[model samples]
Target: MHIQMNDIYKAFGANQVLTGVHFDLKEGEVHALMGENGAGKSTMMNILTGLHKRDSGKIVIDGEERYFDNPKEAEKHGIAFIHQELNVWPDMTVLDNLFIGKELRSPFGLLKTKEMKALAKKQFDKLAVTIPLEKEAGLCSVGEQQMIEIAKALMTNAKVIIMDEPTAALTEREIEKLFNVINALRKEGVSIVYISHRMEEIFAICDRITVMRDGKTVDTQMVSETSFDEVVRKMVGRELTDRYPERNPNIGDTILEVKNATRQGVFEDVNFSVKSGEIVGVAGLMGAGRTEIMRALFGLDQLDSGEILINGQKASIKNPFEAVKRGIGFITEDRKNEGLVLDFSIRENMALPNLTSFSKNGFIAYKTETDFVDMLIKRLRIKTESGETSAKNLSGGNQQKVVIAKWVGIGPRVLILDEPTRGVDVGAKREIYQLMNELTDRGVAIIMVSSELPEVLGMSDRILVVHEGKISGELLKNEATQEKIMTYATGGQ
Candidate 1:
């Protein structure tokens, strides 16, 4: 299943995202497409999977030139893509999800329910995935959801499979399982195109690597023959020294303190304190109550019992308004759900948290709002046409910037970021990391909840691991590692 994209050219209005990008994927091999965020990686994937039409290109699959009108056409030609966002329906069971569009039928055209369940089970068993077949897709962990997406791809009997940032939310152990599954697929002669920002995973799983920068193909090399630094330099087009900046040892008074926080079954006994000018990372496995704890702190969830102290004063935060007034900001994990209003313009979204500042005597001030939004867009390097552009129209990385811009617009002393870079690409991820350092430099107390071990280790001044609704352990930056974090996360004493 060799895939060849010859001289691909694509553009959005005056913006040319992919300029003569060319690459080849060999049969039974894992090929990685590495690039900075907004470097045409997603655009290339969309072109290959038929989500977007290329302006000009030659797509040869198994030596046959074909044009795909849509994703179904690509699927019919043995091509499947598992996007970074899970496409499974939340209300559908695993059995129903897997067989939704292509259900087996009897002679009378009646749906074959038992056959679908058996087939879904067989698919999971074949991959050694242990998720319950009858459970709703939304109830599973992020890693489990990813595995189900993989299983869905396998069910298509695809000869060529494209995985976009598949391990972004997976744990170390879960990542290993995915690697095994990929290897099995390779043994069965399926070619895989893997897109990822993690250099370690790319080197571990990919056989060949193609680097893209500024919408152009920079170089292609065998994974064994290239170094991580060289690959990163190529992707970023510059030397990125010190991925994590050193913290200024200027610890001030505790800005926020939570004592014996409990929210019934969601989380309990979550005790933590974040000081000014420090970054505290909450590290844990998926569904380990990390997000729930943050939600309680942000006054988004009802707490059964707890005490919240802001600036050494006990404060009761009934909702986001009160929380914001107390100098607290929460950037939710689900950006689409809680962070940004997609239909609103960038100016409207950015000015949402600062309506009071942009209002004068009960009247909205559009000029002030637009001025602040423009400043934020420029400061964050958010690539949008204007502040008037709709939030939904921006790319994934740009949309994340919009969310951050909204929070920064209001001037928060205490910031809470949940999975800040969950599915962001390489370039945007670096920008976000640098932004975090800038925030801490300004004496802002930052609390981050992340499932990625590397991010926890790289960015945090301190790490707290949670297990089954309890704070299991805390470690200084010097003591935090993948092994140490996993030990505490799995209930080790």
Candidate 2:
């Protein structure tokens, strides 16, 4: 074995995140770590990378027993990590970013600019990547940035590498290229620990799979010996026959419509409609205008030209406040930054959208606000000690529920959910899916934008595939399939 972890226990106060977690890795092998949100996968990675001190545990690397005080120490031992959110200098060129700390210097310790660019080009060429070494890292797309991060890790000649959801923002072709790069790394006898929620990818790329549930290792087996369903059962502890709830089948009158929507360079000539009680899913690769479309509809962005019709009446939405006033709710993808007020109490945040409804003659009524928030807390099944607790105190899944509940409190006619379940757990995902069903049954229109193909196919009554800032194809619920959606997303013939 190249690396071994034993009885790793970590906790934050009373909440034990990881309990006696054991894991092992061998050279020339790709090991996968699977778990739900808040299941301690990230915590364990942080421990390995020396970001967090474990309460108790023993970590062995290459037959040497050592403790890492920080990530620099881990790097000194040929250990590197590629996080989901990449770490790259946006303002600097590729060469500058690659040699930021350890630069190519002359004998007098003078900067060697020529050597840095040459080495950067060599690294990219070796990885079969064509990223311009002189170009600014910030100008590259997310996929290109991921490649740069991977190239940076490989530059260290690290023996052990850990990647966390590296393909979360990549397209199908980009993902395939990443898998090829990983295979090349494995051929070089490097040990890799891959973490992701996509089961298909785990089975396709990993040599060994380890399932973790509620902070403990449940099982670890060779990838060839296990089936996908078996892994799902172990990870979730239940059979999830349906990823999405069944549609109501009967269609209602159109509640929201956009005609010839044009946002100049963003999206152009877009036309779509969502009926009352219908769930319309918009799927596309990253930067394919999915989120941009939603943002424009909710007035978070300016549209060069478009006509928005609400319930057969022309509506003009110039800002978010006006959007909310028109009975339209938007739950943004960036929950931490845009969806919730981290420092505010849950009760206070929940009353933000419709605070006027809780006020009498401009005077707020605390008792009435508390009562309504209490009801929302119960209805959403939010796992929190009290409504007065800060939003940051809750887990990711619970915080997401609070965001949804906050929008639901406004009693919206049309809901636009952008990656509503992006970082949430499986159980929380099921709850959110069921909540969507309940809302549609009550005659609410939902326009959802998600990167997960299964979710888009399962939950939507209709699917619209956007490509290069335009609607490439549209499919009814029965006609939508993963392969078909992917074809449209990539501009397939």
Which candidate gets the maximum lDDT versus the true structure? 1
Instruction: Assess every candidate by TM-score.
Output: 0.95, 0.88
How big is the positional error of residue 373 in model 2, measured in Å on the Cα after superposition? 5.6
lDDT (tens digit, per residue) of candidate 1 on 352-419: 98999988999998887878888888887887778988888776667888888899777899999988
lDDT of 1 at 190: 95
The worst-scoring run of ten residues by lDDT in candidate 2 lies at 242-251
RMSD value for candidate 2: 3.2
Residue-level lDDT for 349 in candidate 2: 88
How well is each residue in 374-433 modelled by candidate 2, as lDDT tens digits? 999998777666899899867566778889999988989999998888656565687789
Off by over 4 Å in 1: none
**Model 1 collision count:** 1
- State each candidate's clash count: 1, 0
lDDT of 1: 0.86
Error of 2 at 67 (Å): 1.3
